[model samples]
Target: MDSLSYTPRGVLTPQRSLADLTWLRVGGPADWFFQPADEDDLAAFLKALPADVAVFPMGVGSNLIVRDGGIRAVVIRLGRGFNGIEVDGETVTAGAAALDAHVARKAAQAGRDLTFLRTIPGSIGGAVKMNAGCYGSYVADHLISVRIVTRAGEVQTLPAEALNLAYRSSQLPEGAVIVSATFRAAEGEPGALEARMVDQIAKRDASQPTKERSAGSTFRNPSGASSTGRADDTHELKAWAVIDKAGMRGATLGGAQMSEKHSNFLINAGGASAHDLEQLGEEVRKKVLQTQGISLEWEIMRIGEY
Candidate 1:
């Protein structure tokens, strides 16, 4: 790649190992890793960098599996400068790096109901990108608008409608980095909201393998409907049920296993390479297709070379 015309104030590292950066802790390296000092630094760096150089905007790595061979691109990670949260009336604005749980608590403290985010992993950016939802509430239900810096370094605010948000997916302009999001929440008493979130957390911990090394849910429901991915959707098919019927619950290959607590969860029980986890998932998929005749789609995002 050609040298950049401008020098950014941010820290940049070459061939940075990515295992430590991901929740799975199994990826190789990123060709370049950039942590911008601020929004201006990020924009300028993207503007000055060569057009052919790829850019990957990463959240907290909560729902990702970067491959063993690493990413051949500049992986941009937002930090403190981009993690501010603000509340005004029923509207809450949060930076991309702000944790979903933090945003939920802050909004609840301000007497606005965003308690659905309290149990979800990762940041607001990833939430918006995936249309994350829980307890019948979704980012698509509350998101008003988003501020993003396009791959060309042009900043723009787009309405929530601009993104075709649906079940576990949304469409953003390719390579655009989400800087912040604004959500209009319902008004509720702080005490009541806190209580609701507490109950939600208790339920999640009881059902999911919260203490294990896992990347949330492994597969999407096989319904293929475009509506929200609620537990009570019309089609109402669950991935875990299918996995259980296929007899792959608690199944293991190498160090990776489908969690006994939640068959939909793919966990690293001990020392698991990315290959082990991915291959095990593929095996589950193959088994489900062969036995149940239902194809499963991955919910976790996997990237980079293998």
Candidate 2:
């Protein structure tokens, strides 16, 4: 691999271990890890670097599983300089690096209802990238636009329509780094919003293994006719219910197990390797397919190599 020739004000490290940067805490090193000081620094570095060098922009590693073999591309991580949050009227502008929880709390405090983000563990960038939704509300329902840096070092603002957002997915331009996003939230009483968020936290804690090391939901709910036994039924089938029905709840492989508390979660139950977690997930898929005849789709993004 060619060494990166350009240097910017941001911190750059080669062969940086990625295990500590992710929620699941199991991965190999990134060939190059770049923490940009600001948008200008990021743009300049990308403009000067060889066009062949692949760039992967990552947010807080909440819903990701990087393989043990690590990533070959340059991993761009936004930090302090990109975490600002501001509110005007009912619109909230947040930097891509800001946590979804923080954004939700701030928006709620400002009497704007963005409560759907309160329980999500990812950063704003990931939330936008995934069209993250919970409790029936999604980012696609509130996002106004996003400011992004293109792969060729150009800055552009794209409206929400450009993303073609769907259930837990969005079509963002490849290699585009989201710098900031504007969301139009609804007006609400501050006290009511705060109380609602508290209730959500409590509900999540009661239902999920919140203290464990897991990548949120492991699979998406099966939709349409596939979910229902009858072709006329349109209701989605929950992933957890199917896994439970398959008798794979609390199933283990190595140190990885599907959480007993919530069958949808794939947990690193002490000393679990990335391979173990991934293998366990695949096992669940096989069991579900064999017993329920419904193929499950992954909700968590698995990257890098095995």
Candidate 3:
């Protein structure tokens, strides 16, 4: 595990603290942290990396929880070189590191509608991986294809259908790192699109705890149960409603509290640890199941050792 072996044109560090890299500010550290100079650098480094080593591709760390014990893997974070956004007629191609909001705004400026991404946090990479959506539109709806560097350092292009995207999930190959994504956007008046994004931000701020140190929604809308406790695939029952029913809306553990403003938001009220945040989320899940008989599924990606 030395830089000489890879000969990378990137910044590499061992035992790097990850707390600052995450939104919640709670993770311990990464075994090794790497910020590649560009896509070529990333592919080259990955090619030289040992097969037994693990790779964790990180976005802006918006909806993640790295455990207190830290990840024993190489954490790769894309930066400036991979954040370009290009518009061509009806298509918008965005680099993996480009912020979702930025891409949305850029598309809107080009008189295209990608307004769905304006309120979503993190980067295009994470959005594609999670199939992120908002306001009735999803990445899957407009995605044409994606470029990725596989774990073995081979670059490949995969069509949108190849991903098998569904309900906030995708079938990306294991250890592959998304480099860019192309989306075919609908035509729209630039002014109209910008106004729509403005409205979305206002709505999100009014309902969600956007001002707090939160990892967005803690759980997905229960996909199997309705509010009446019957099985329903339509996912009509929202996670917050179930949490409110369980009486855990304003629940707290250490400095972690389910935001009073939005029950589904797991927030660091102040000085919270990763353990505290995760434990509180589990507690909420337990209560919801106990009271409503509906098991909740987490939306936030939690990784590393406890």
User: What's the count of clashing pairs in each model shown?
Assistant: 0, 0, 0
Residue 213 of model 1: what lDDT? 85
**Residues 1-306 of candidate 2: C-alpha lDDT, one tens digit per residue:** 465566789998899989999889999989899999999999888887788888999888889899999998889999999999999998999999999999999999999999999999889999998888778778888999999999988989999989887777788888989999999999999999999999999999999999999989999878733211232123457889999999999999999999999999999999988999999999999999999899999999998988
CA displacement after TM-score superposition, residue 175 of candidate 3 (Å):
0.5
Model 2, residue 153: C-alpha shift (Å):
0.8
Better of 1 and 2 by TM-score: 1
Best by TM-score: 1
How much does candidate 3 score in TM-score? 0.96
Model 2: ten consecutive residues of lowest lDDT: 224-233
Model 3 per-residue lDDT tens digits across residues 191-253? 999999999999999999998999888998886432222232245678899999999989999
lDDT of 1 by residue, 1-306 (tens): 558887989999999988887787888899999999999999999888888999999999989999999999999999999999999998999999999999999999999999999999999999999999878888988999999999999899999999988889989998899999999999999999999999999999999999998889899888775545454355668899999999999999998999999999999899998999999999999999999899999999999999
- Cα lDDT, model 2, residue 259: 96
**What's the C-alpha lDDT at position 304 in model 2?**
92
- Which is the better candidate, 1 or 2, if ranked by lDDT? 1
Q: What is the lDDT of residue 33 in candidate 3?
A: 96
Q: For model 2, what is the error of residue 108's alpha carbon versus the real structure, in angstroms, after optimal superposition?
A: 1.0
